[model samples]
Target: MTNTPANEKWFQDRATEQIHLEQLQRAERFNGRAAMLGIVIGIITEGLTGAGIAHQIGLGPLIDGYTACRTQFLPFCF
Candidate 1:
């Protein structure tokens, strides 16, 4: 069809809508990364707590520090 005023308006509206959608997607991505970081910090905190407990009980040799903790709630060196 010919590029009439109505057609131009429609295109502009579509473009605006696309920009809004993209903005929302970026916000979601940023929030998701932040949430992941929080989760990792929580895991590290738990690892530290476990290590402290092991140390208190004289079991420090069985596991590593919190930095190497993965999968298991506590870090195990061996």
Candidate 2:
């Protein structure tokens, strides 16, 4: 039997949804791998530098500078 218009529309919708889902899954897998790689790099750098991840990335100094600037009490800022 030939497919009805309604059946064709439904099939098209399903195909579109499947494509969208596959794209999302691929993007998620890529993001996860990138995150893992970043973590590994950070760990290696920390080991070599003898510094915590935050300090290695300058996050510690940035936060300290921000806090000092906000409080206007610390000797160093920025």
Candidate 3:
């Protein structure tokens, strides 16, 4: 077939689609690896400090406060 404008546009569109698909795959791979690394780090920290990830990150007190407030039926809890 001749190298018409329509053919050029079609080829460009296909190329763009292929590039986008590749980028998405790469991003997904990176996200998965990062999540796995975070889990491993959390486990190591917990083993070393005898504290869970939430406690290490200071969420323990916040959670405890929420639980206490819920049980006490505090007016501001809602």
Candidate 4:
């Protein structure tokens, strides 16, 4: 347990690493919360729209376009 200069530097390095790890953990938690909020918002929007409502929002055209593309690019798709 000698309080040598190298020992002090090692302790400082570990402390810096620990601080970085804690910061990363906090950031991850914040990211998880943001993702959950987005999911909740999406669910609410989808529920408000109700089932079989995509046609009202012009998704029929989008789906038709996708179908056409898929049909054209059969090998790329399947």
Candidate 5:
């Protein structure tokens, strides 16, 4: 069987659309991974900053203050 001009154009268009869709999906996945990595780094940095602050002020007092603050404020925030 032979393909007519219209059929050839249709096939080409379909292939192009498939390739474009795949590229978009790959871009979205990469962006999602990057965002997740960024969140993880942010959490780690926050934890490190908190730890340094705790060390400077003394661990026992920091924990007591955090516990008291959380206990008082967390219920209202939630």
Candidate 6:
């Protein structure tokens, strides 16, 4: 039996492809977890800020004032 260089090259190529695929899967899972954590932190931060603002200027009045200003003010900020 003769072992050819072409056969060796084919095996090496397949091994490289598999390693790259594994690395890609690991990166995707890491990114997904990071995104979920970021979203949770963002929600908590927004809730805390809103609560602090309400406490400073009465909850009911603050909400009413925000509702009134939002229609006119949000467009410019966005």
Q: Which has the greatest lDDT?
A: 3
Off by over 4 Å in 6: 51-78
Candidate 6 per-residue lDDT over residues 1-78, each given as its tens digit: 776999899999999999999999999999999999977776776587764434444586667567767777554422
What lDDT score goes with residue 35 in model 4?
90
Q: What's the lDDT of the predicted structure labeled candidate 4?
A: 0.78
Q: What would the per-residue lDDT of candidate 3 be over residues 1-78, giving only the tens digit for each residue? A: 689999999999999999999999999999999999999999999999899898888899887778878898666773
lDDT of 2 at 13: 100
Best by TM-score: 3
Model 1 Cα shift for residue 30 (angstroms):
0.4
A best-first ranking of the candidates according to their lDDT comes to 3, 2, 4, 5, 6, 1
Candidate 4 C-alpha lDDT tens digits along 1-78: 779999999999999999999999999999999999977776777788763335445687667667877789544542
Q: Against the correct fold, how does model 1 do in TM-score?
A: 0.60
- List ranges where model 4 is wrong by over 4 Å: 50-64, 71-78
Deviation (Å) of 47 in candidate 6? 1.5
Q: Write the per-residue lDDT of candidate 2 for residues 7-78, one digit (tens) a residue.
A: 999999999999999999999999999999999999998899888788877699777677778898776666
Computed on alpha carbons, the lDDT of every model, listed in order, comes to 0.75, 0.90, 0.91, 0.78, 0.77, 0.76
Error of 1 at 19 (Å): 0.4
User: Backbone clashes per model, in order?
Assistant: 2, 0, 0, 0, 0, 0
Better of 2 and 4 by TM-score: 2
